[model samples]
Target: MTTALPSGLASAGLNAGEQELLDRVGQVARACAERADHYDRTARFPADDFDDLFAAGLNAPTVPREHGGLGLGPLSRDTLTLWLVTKELAKADLSLGRCWEGHANALVLVDALGSAEQKRRWFDGVVTRGEKWVGWSGEPQAPKPGEKRRFGTSVVRDDGAWVVTGTKVFATSATGAQWAILLVDTEGPGGARHAPDGRDSLLMLACDLSDPSVSVDDSWWDPIGMRATVSHLVRFDGTRLPDANVIGAPGAYLREGWQTAFIPHYAASFLGAAEAAYEYALKYVIRQDKVADPYVQHRVGSMAVDVESAYLWLRHVATLWDTGKREEARLAGSRARHVVEHLALRTVDNCVRVCGARSLIRPSPVERILRDLTFYVRHDNDDQVLATIGRALLGQEHDASFYKP
Candidate 1:
C-alpha cells in the first residue's frame, strides 16, 4: 500500500544529478520499507539494505573523486533532501536509516577532515569496493574531572602511534562495521575551556576493528522502541592507531564551530523519522474506519499542521546552514533537530492514538516507528538549550549572540 504523506509537498525541480540521486535512493528505500517488519520481528540486522547502500555510495556522500565518491556531488541545500531521503528509508525501515546515519558520520569525517593521503588510501577503500562500516571510539573526560567517559575513549601515544582505551556505547552497528572513525586525545597534556580533562584532546583516527584490543559485545539494547537497531556495547581495551590514521586536526572534533556543520547530517536522521511517521500515518489513519469519527479527525488535523510546520523549520535551518550563518545555524541546528526528533515522537503518538490497538500489533510499521522515534526523542540538552535560547532572547547573558560567530 502506498503511504500518503501528512500534507502536500511543494513542487520543486531537481537538476539532473540531484534528481538522479534522489530517484536511486528512493528505490533502496522501497526495498527497506518492504522488509522493515520482518527485520523488526526477528531483531535481524538490515545487512542487505546496507549492502545496497554501499553499492550506491550513500555511505560516502562527500568523498571526492580522487578518493572514490561521486566527487563532491550536489545535494540540494535548500530542501530537506537528507530528511526526505531518510524519511523514505525510515518509512520503509528505520534500522537501515540508522545504519546509514553512522556511515554518513564517518563519511563526513573522512571528507572534511581526512588528510590527503588518508583520503587517497581509505576513501579509495570505500569507493573502489565499499569498505567496512566505521564506528566512533573516543570518550574524553568531562572538564570538571568527575564526568565519566563522554565522547571518545582515551588517546595515549605509544611508539609514535596512539593507543586508545575506553568504550563508546550506543555504537549502532559495531558487529558489522570493518573500520571506525575514532576520537582520541592527542594533546596528552593541556587545559582549556572545553578541555577539562587536561588532555588537549579530540582526534579523529581511522581504526581497523580487527585489532585484538577492540571487542564487540552482544547486542544489549532492549528499548521501548527501535528494537532492531543492533546497538550494543563496544570496548576498546587500549586499541592502537597508526599515526597515518589521524583524520583531522588534533582539536577539531569538539571545537565550537564543528557542531554547526557536523550536527546537521545527523539531524536529517530525526527529520527522516518524523517524516516517516508523517508519511506512514496518513495512509494508516485513512484506512482505519475508527478514525473517521469527528474527534479523531481533530487529532489527525493537528498532526498534519505539526508535520508541515516541522518541515518548514527544517528547511529554514538548512538555509541558515548553507548561507554561512554558523551561529544561527548552530542554534537552529539544535532546535531543528530537537523539533524534528520530538515531532517524530509526537507524530507517532498521534498514530497510536488515531489508529488504536492496530498500531501495537506485532510486525506493524506503526510499532516500528514507536521504537525508532522514541530513541531519537531521548537526545540530550533540551531544557538547557531552551533556557539558553530564552536567556538570549531576554537580553540576558546567554543571548543568541552568545552562540553567534
Candidate 2:
C-alpha cells in the first residue's frame, strides 16, 4: 500500500543512506496503516506502529551526528527530512505521527540547550534503550472563580530534588511513555518567586514517568477522533525529580526558537492526512467506475490543487529553515500552518462529498481519516494565528524575497 510521492515533492540533498531510511519507513507505514483502525476503535496506543518505527531506527531522530543520529536538523537544521518522515507516518496514521513528533520535539530541546550529560543520557535512552518520550505543557486552568488564568503546575526545590505538583492535560502518548518533558513554574513554596535573571518563570524538567507519585488518568481522553493518541491527564502528586533532571535554564525552551521550527511538523501531519483522504477518494471513484464522470473529475481536480498548494507551502517553509532564514521562517511557518489547515480541511470535506455515504461506513479508509484530520487540525485558533501574521507585517518591514508568491 505504499504510494509513490508525486514527482514535484522530491527533496534535495539527501544522501543514499537517508533515501534508504525513507524507503524503510514506507514499509513501516504499511504496517501502521493495517493496524490503525483497530487501535482507533479500542482507543489503545499504537504500540505496534512505534515498535516498527523503532526497529527501523527512526525512534531517535536527534541523536548527535557523531552518535549516528539525524541531528537537530529535524527541528531546524534538517527540516525537509523531518517533514518527509512525519508526513509519511501521518499518511498512515495521524495519531502515531503526533506522538512521534512530540518525542522528536523533546529531543531537539535537549540537543539545543541541555548540558552534555543531559544530552548523552536522554539520547542514549531513545537510541539505545528504545524508550519513548512525551511532552506535557498544557494544563487546565485552576477552577476557582475570579482567579487569573495561568499555569497550575509548579515545581519547587526539596532535599536536592524538584517536587512537582499539579495536573497536565493533553499529555500525548502518556499511556506508555518512559520519560516526560514537563513545563512547570519555578516559583517555590512562597508562591510567586521569579527567575533570578528576570526571565520568564516557566521552566522545563525531564522526569521519569515511573515515579511513584505520578499517575495518568486515562478516563478524560475520550474524544471525537485521534482516540488512539491516548492524550490523557497526568498528575504529579509531589513527584520527586532529581536536580540533574532540570533541562536548560528557565525560559530556555521558548528562548531557543525550536517551537517556531516545530510548527511545520504539525503542518506536515495535516497535509499527510489530507493526502490519504485524497488517495482514498481516488480509489473509491476508480472502483465505482465513476472516474469519467464530469462531477467526479471536477472534484478530484480541485482536490489536486489544494494538495499541491499544501506541498508548495511545506517546501517553502522547509527551505526557509534550511537556508537559515530564522525570522522569515518563523513568519512563513505561522502563515503556512493556517494555510495548510484550511487546505487540509477542504481536501477532506471534498473527498467525503465525492465518495458519498458509503465511504462513511466502517472499515473505509476515508472514514477514519476524515475524523482524525477534523480533530487534529483544531490544535490552534485560526483567528489568533492570522492576527499574529498581520501584526508582524504591520510592525516590521520585510525583504521582497520573503513574500514572493
> On a 0 to 1 TM-score scale, where does candidate 2 land against the true structure?
0.90
Q: What lDDT score belongs to each candidate, Candidate 1 first? A: 0.62, 0.78
Error of 1 at 130 (Å): 1.8
Candidate 2 deviant stretches above 4 angstroms: 1-8, 12-15, 72-76, 142-151, 187-199, 396-405
lDDT of 1 by residue, 134-192 (tens): 54542323543664434445567799888877666556667667788765455542112
User: In model 2, which range of ten residues has the least summed lDDT?
Assistant: 189-198
Give the poorly placed runs of model 1, Cα more than 4 Å off.
1-13, 42-44, 70-79, 135-152, 186-199, 290-292, 391-405
**Clash list (residue pairs), candidate 2:** 73-77, 73-78
Best by lDDT: 2
C-alpha lDDT (0 to 100) for residue 109 of candidate 1: 66
